[model samples]
Target chain A: MSNAAIPVTEYSTPQRGWYKRNEIAITPWLFLAPGVFFFLVYVIFPIFQSFNLSLYRWDGLGQAEFIGMANYQELVSDRAFEVSLWNNLKWLILYLLAIPAGLFIALFLNQTVTGIRLYKSLFFFPFVISQIVVGLVFTWFYDPTFGLLNVMLGWVGLGPINVLGDPSIVTYGIIAAGLWPQTAYCMILYLTGLNAVDPEQIEAARLDGARGWRMLWYVIVPQLKPATFIAFVVTIIGALRSFDLISIMTNGGPFGTSRVLSFYMFEKALSEYGFRMGYGAAIAVVLFLIMLIFIAYFLWSMFQEERGR
Target chain B: MFPTPIEKTSRTWQITYQTFLPLALLLWLMPLLAVALFSIKPEADFVSGGYWSLPTYFAGLENYGRVFFQSDMPRYLLNSVLITIPTVIGCVILSSMTGFALGIYRFRSNIWIFFMFVAGNFVPFQILMVPVRDLTLDLGLYNTKTGLVLFHIAFQTGFCTLFMRNFIRALPFALIEAARVEGIAEWRIFWYVVLPLMKPAMAALAVLIFTFIWNDYFWAVVLTQGAESQPVTAGITSFNAQYRAAYHLMSAGSIVAALPPVAMFFLMQKHFIAGLTLGAVK
Candidate 1:
């Protein structure tokens, strides 16, 4: 209304060109401000805050007492923390088995059989559901007396083993559940990669008498690198942040045996067990540092690709 | 084709492959199959000698009913819907605007801001747990559904913006130039000129975020405390506690909770896959 009331000549005569350039320049920032503001407040700033908080000792509500590297020092000596760290290592190592498993499934389903597409979607079903649901499904599957695994085992006269109840096998059992969805995820990625695979190259390789593993190794594997890279990246992240399944399945128990760093951090910070915010932040920092390695690699690849463009 | 196709292989190998396909699938999905059967089986089968047997009677309705009435399953469902819907809408809207700005503009900070969102998207949520929870408390939004929705929207904007920006960047720039030539305002260029062309991207993002945020257990747990505000994931934790021996009910609950995303994936599988593999392969 005010702009309409004022004449265009009054507003646009003298400084219009300078104003227009500045206006053009500021437009992007204007568009960016809200998102950037929220990101800074919620995502970016919290990262540094958590990092700083890692150096202090505070149970969330109290005044934080600066404790330098004390939290890190205690982390070095914390046995349960060590167990969780080892379990995380176990998760990282074992979770990777899904990639090959996925490829195997993808290969099996990639054929142009009748109903193959439906089968593929059904195969990918696990990846669709939330991990919490996966955890529950597996929890029932591993139930000792009446759980599916034990019941199936009993057919061969095997005893019902309390899978989640036993500390030794618990992490494996949960990781197995995790692998269900993860493997499906990898299979989908590989399936898409397979769809895009060059037919001529395959024919050329096959004509050379390259069969079985040789064809896969010399031809297919090289072409699938990008898919494999992405699958590997997501799998690693999934394995590391594997808190949902762990939390749901066992609460990192039968005695914290199944605890990954992400779960352990939450358990430390929020659960009734204790609200050690600083300690939780310290665990988070450790997790962040570890994840940063992968993040850097991904970013470097992305940057390289951008530059190549 | 890479393995020389199964057709040209030996008949024995072909038969073996055919037989092995079902066997491998059976073994692979054994756990899920068990849950599927348990989801329908009466409590008697689990109570009796075998959990592995064919269910004597289908109690699908019974099991599902118990999950609903015997627990706060209904509330949890409602909560999941509430949290997921807004987060999807909010993240999409915010990202669209941001994506448009970053993708279309050639400013120096555009790339920087893009990277920032991309980097932030991948960080473990645990690092955000404490401060986010604290901030929620400070804002008096703790233990509220709104609190979770707000945080989820903010956190997910990082990812959504990255996806949206990349997607928008791939769009032809001539549209924007044409819009400018038409003297359409910046915001209208976005709403009228750009957004209609962005339907696929928006759909792709909606499905992706719906699944991501729906499956989100960590924030749901961190932000909401009681049954009133808690999501299905957290609700399931408590539900499992009360229904300790009710495997039948639990199985049904799991299915019900899992249904939306499963259905979403089936219905929008193409878009979901497109979104997930957006920057992955090429």
Candidate 2:
């Protein structure tokens, strides 16, 4: 309104360039240019491209035919897809156990003792280590032939159970290995959350005889919402992205029972068998759709918070 | 404090808690302890089925020596270093600028732009896998550390921007406003006023990205094939394939691969946790 009221040629200084005149707005775009360009090229465009690619039949090296809905149609009849989807559901549900397990560990480790800092760091060791190493360590730990698990099973006079080789229990075994690090991640989040817990509230609750799980449920848990939310987000993403472990431990085997969507997509698209680019993109689309649900919820939550602020 | 601190607890319980702490830690770290034990054991022990027993002789030097000197582990480790460092530097530079823009300015598309980065960060990597690979291949960057680094920088910019923006938002706005009033250039305000204050955030992000990129097995496998370009996480699998059934050598290799990030965490423990739990507090 002010700029319209006063002529720019008469009011504005001639020495200032257009960039200086609109520095505030132009600077932001200038700053955002590289990051936005990179993100759009690599992350954003690829997403839409994946969605489009899923509708075609492409071998990745040859011509891509527009075969709309055929990939989805094949997915309906595909047993491997069924197993992968079911395993994804299993991963999503079971991976949430990390939150509670992490809370439990954090509560246990919350006390200040001599060398507690060292103890805390040591407890967080699994999370810091790469999942590949975790996979390898757990692979050896669960090894049937002279594995520590079988060794302990023998201590209890139980027969050796081949965890990775057994198709029925293979997914569960991988999930367990995944849980080890995930639990540590959650524990650390909760530990940090625990630190910022309002001491006065706790004291007041204590004065009212609120102790043990009662105080935790009503007071502590409410304060830990931020941590719980983060834990939930990371755990869900980690579960859905359970590729490296599967790739390392089982290679989607014992008849491909443990193939989650991410791993299965890689297998279909790029693995030695053949390049089913469209099929892989279709699998990836399904995974993305599943993720979109949670993404929407998260964005909505953040939006609400942003509006509140 | 929530558990009614052990200091106020019964004497016997305190004693029990003290003893239990170490025991719990031992049990929690049992698998890693097993690996550490394996890494130090002689090859003869594994052949004789002495997996659970104490080592007959210390071969820590020998096993790690083989990993460091005998295998393609060093090349893979160097590749990881090359890939990880450049990605971290690029993310830090790019996100700080984006973060500065999103944080300080109030624009019409601000919130939506912020959400885009957040949403993209949370998207499944598989969604971007095919195109990114094709793009990398087309660019003649396939089987190169530069490709991995480039993709990592781009992809990681999402989370880094989120973190950096929030960090910037928490800073005193008056400083930037003051700089502007004093006729400081906008970039000068960012460089002189904001970037100095963002050191802690950058430190936090550096360590976090270091760990993340170093442990990135998916992209390493997806983009690069051989030891020449693959990071240690992907390399460790091939390392295992080379020394199949040689648990000692594999354990040594695994330990070596996982060590850099672990060391980064411990050394930068405060910053790492701060970066990780950025949103967990508020």
Candidate 3:
């Protein structure tokens, strides 16, 4: 009886401590601590650090000099920066073509023939491989002397048109290579979305005389709104983050005509030429602000969804 | 059903589609097919500039042998495995917890925290490049696979959290409520109750993160260098440089580098698609 009383007293004393009383409120904080800490240290804080670093002139090793607005002013006169900005604009506009192209392919392949699954997977093959490999394959395909493109062109009675070598069309060539994998990605998204598509609506629309383009536009496409939204989000992100293909294919070559803001920032900060940390940070800031618009839209939409729930 | 299914179409159209299917697929995969052909061709074929013709003799064995035995491809591949596997495991573990906290709990800052992850995930790698590199260097993890793995986990946690939170939200809340009614501890409920239910999400996330971390080139370049720590994506660049004009060897190397992710996709095609299109279907 005395031993039982002693054990019960020891347990009772600490059982009602603050933690026990506030378990529900504090448990989440405990669960969230490590993830929040890691995210803050890595992803969230670096954004502001990059912003602050843009205002200072640092070569990565030497003492950073306070050079507020100088970096931004230099950006105004930099020719390479101008070229990079224009290339980025081109990327943004051209990269969006993946959506419609993807929809077309999805529509084409959404059938149940023998071995169609294999065909669908094969069609989606490009998206699965690394972009580096894609870049390399496309590079060879565009080679002037012995490329298949030239080989085909020869068959059509056209001489070799050096696609990658010609500065005028270099960006377009890279964009086309990029479109291959991107279109595959959007196609998969649409395929999944099409599975969830309401078949009854299609029947109703068909009975009401909607066919082909009209049916796809008025009935099918609306059912794919969720897919379309996801496709838009990912495609925009992919467009802006097009570093691998550019780096691999052209290396911002043909008189630096293919340099996008991302590659240019890397070149400025870390490459062999020199380290202009502040300038690179400035370029990144511009790119970030551009992406900010899309991020804001996505978050807002998601927030609306959350509140609706 | 949307395209009126090929079976329901006219005979000529059906016949055309049957023929057209292989033709379109061939066109779609032309570049890859070319690379595949290149990988199997002899050096003599490349020298003769007969790239389109059948290989003079199949050198697939020799070229792939050279890539496997005569180069640093193996080392780079090993590093990729080391880096990618750890990153996938770390992200899955970290995000699952964060997802649970956000999904099941009622907290004032929940939406804001969730938004932070979503927004961070979308930010360009360039924005995080300089500072992340700096942070890695400060920790004395420069040019190390651990450095790359740590960064990938932290960064990937953003996307994984978004995925897991949404997935968890879709799960019925009655299970959690019942567990709570039985006087289970929250962490116990997470481990025993929610974790069991999260198997599908965990599987989906595992395959997705594997592909993503495996295909990563930017961070691989930024965080590590040389064959000792570099993944195959970056290693392929150096491999090409070494065999600058050797199209057969380069093609073989590229195919070797690209094979793993392709295999992963085919093996986990369902989960991969589910993970990628988490929100695309209502």
Candidate 4:
């Protein structure tokens, strides 16, 4: 936060070289006003408002009642909340599968073959489309009748199955829809990373008879750490905030089996499930606190890198 | 280099690699290809049997015709364009100025403000949803494209500032000092000196912001209600609802809603990847 506070002292303090040199100065506030003002009202202020709203009960437009941590207490007992929380952990773990899937695709595409450029873009088409559309496509694919999945299953002499209608399979179905685009996203990231990988190190490894999985596990993976880190960050964030697919695919159904904290918060705060604003805010607060730990680490690492550069 | 580029392999293996490349790509893109095929299937085909096999009769025009003529797609597309273009422009300008001020000026708050913007960018949208929607309603900006644009620009500024500031900080400070030594006004230094150096950052951010805003579903739900101001994502939902039995039309609508970003990816593929993979190389 001190980084934001620095503009004032660095500009307004009397001892600066530029301050002494310029004949007259515009108000320092004039320079800082627009960005800071927007930050305060739109970004900064709403955060506190969310925190405050978590202390009360209000249904968007209704009268409010102060409940303090009562909303938080309700979260502890809500079975649906527990289910969503557990599913979110599954999402976080399963989503990392995209990182390696992406790396493998990236490595495959990194070859110097003809038509590889077209192949790369074709593989990337999923990431370009919005998740809502992806969900809709997957929903149709997963439809029990006249759908691709069932059609494929019929070939294997299996009965038609309702993937989205079964509670046990719904979260994985949605995650699979999500991974369609996510794996593409990670693939694109790693493709770029692989493009810039040092050739000398690989040549040295090759001379030592390193090849296949041995070379990949030892040399290539270490060089792709930054890409992996970024892929992990984005995948985790995408998984935790896995709402669009849930909303579009099944509305957290087969009995809210696909809900994550994001969709659950929306359902609690602003949907037909009844607007329990305080309770919703508490759910959001938990998600925020969890995300903060990752963000803090990301920023700390970024700062260290910045100082190094 | 990592896997031994396919060029140096044996001739037989090279032929195998070349043949397998397209096959792998086709398999990887099979789902999307299915969507494209489903989008063009005739109504009778869907009713007659499964969504497999090539359509006996093409209905691309008919399916697409129904999607546009029967749905609120035009209004939704308009809303997305209106909301996204200004946001791209507004965020680029605001972050450029903020980035300039932070990078060029060595003030006490420089690093702190930079990080605040970065940190704020990471906060979950849920935390901001209730308050932001309420704030929009209170300001009488709810259900309006302008309102959504304002919120997007404000939120996008955080990430853009981090990008813009880092890019600016990487430039030579001596250029600004040289301008200052010539008694150029400080603001002039920003306009004439730094702004020209900003085209690369601006280009990268533009394609990125366009895609992000185009795909935005969360804020679309919160800030805007009806088709008049709802984006393509929201457009997709109502299309999904009304065309419940019309799989062909729904598939067509999905394809249409997806075109702009897909087109953008193809056109700006280089810069798009450059922007997304920016900080991942260190």
- Best-matching candidate per TM-score: 2
Give the per-residue lDDT of model 1 (tens digit) for A1-309.
111111223344565565453544566688888888888888899999999999999998879999999999999999999998999899999999989988888787878756678778888888888898888888878877667788779889988899999998999999999999999999998888888889999888767888778888888888888789888988998989898898888988987888889998988988998999999999999999989998889888888877776
What tens digits encode model 2's per-residue C-alpha lDDT throughout B1-282? 587788999999999999999999999999999999999999999999898799999999999999999889999999999999999999999999999999988778988999999999999999999999999999999999999999999999999999999999888787776777677788998998999999999999999999999999999989999877888998899988888799999999999999999999999999999999999998
> Could you tell which candidate, 1 or 4, scores higher by TM-score?
4
Model 1 docking category = medium
Best by lDDT: 2
DockQ of each: 0.54, 0.66, 0.59, 0.57
Candidate 2: residue pairs that collide: none
Runs with alpha carbons beyond 4 Å of true place in candidate 1 = A1-20, A155-160, B3-16, B181-184
Please give the C-alpha DockQ score of model 1: 0.54
lDDT of 3 at B13: 96
Determine the iRMS, in angstroms, of model 1: 5.2
For residue A215, give model 2's deviation from the true position in Å: 0.8
Residue-by-residue lDDT tens digits, candidate 4, A87-183:
9888988888999999989988888776778888889888888989889889988989877888889999999999999999889888988998999
| Global lDDT scores for all candidate models | 0.85, 0.93, 0.91, 0.85
Worst 10 residues of 4 chain A by lDDT: A1-10
TM-scores for every candidate against the unseen true structure? 0.93, 0.98, 0.97, 0.94
Best by DockQ: 2
How many Å off is the CA of B164 in candidate 3? 0.3
